[model samples]
Target: MGNLKSVALLLLFTFFVLHLPFVESDWFINYHIHVTNDLPLLNSPPNQPNLFLHCKSKKKDLGERPMVKGQDYTWDTKVNFWRTTLFFCRASWVGRKTIRFDAFVADRDEMTCRHYHNSCMWSVREKGIYFSKNNATWGNMYPW
Candidate 1:
């Protein structure tokens, strides 16, 4: 009887340990990333170029997308078990140089996204790209 109880308890503990990371709680956070084109329209030139974006991760590619001023693109993803998930993006316009950046890095963005309700917001402007924890405030993170 004693050996049977010990074996049962060990199995229970093993199950808990193996399933802990997959639990649906704050410990397992799902992140939503929003990339917006906040570039201002040129008043002198009535025509404005569309912003082209290509974002990808090791397992997934978001494909190339175009955004006009004030438009936004959004996606959601979860950090992998190994915590090595990373997403990168490239942005370009008609006449400007292409800008490349890491959109999501599991180790770097986990805490910030966890703190801000699991949302990472980015704004692309004429000068550079900005990051926001909350939609209300913005900070410059990358420059063009």
Candidate 2:
């Protein structure tokens, strides 16, 4: 009886040690959006709609906030399943015109030993807003 109990305890300990790497993480990231005056996303009306970024994170509708030109807004969001999260910004300052642009903030790569900034940065440019993780190349829009 004593021998059987010892074997059971050993197996349990082994399983716990081996599966630690497969466990999912609750790691979160801080995403920053920098709006620039050089790139004008507004239209003729320029209603200056309340600028807010929306993400399909664990919790959507994280609250909306107005954006200021030449300023940055930081949003804290959780990493969804498969360690991926989608984000985009919306502008409906006023009138009937509404726009949704991709912010493209995510980390899809596998976990690595190297230290990662754990933060994604986006900047509004003369052309369209550019993604941080993706190279600042033209027509490099993230999936919708």
Using lDDT, give the best candidate's number. Answer: 1
Give candidate 2 misplaced runs (Cα > 4 Å).
1-58, 80-84, 91-116, 134-144
Clashing pairs in 1: none
65-141: candidate 2 lDDT, tens digit per residue: 65544546555555454556656666433333345664433454223111234444555443344444332433424
The alpha-carbon RMSD values of the candidates against the true structure, listed in the order shown, are 3.8, 6.1
Candidate 2: deviation at residue 57, Å?
Answer: 3.0
Estimate the TM-score for candidate 1: 0.78
CA deviation > 4 Å runs, candidate 1: 1-27, 43-49
- lDDT by residue (tens digit), candidate 1, 52-134: 88999988999998777877889988888677889999988546657998889987887787667799889988888888887
Give lDDT per model, in order: 0.81, 0.46
TM-score of each: 0.78, 0.47
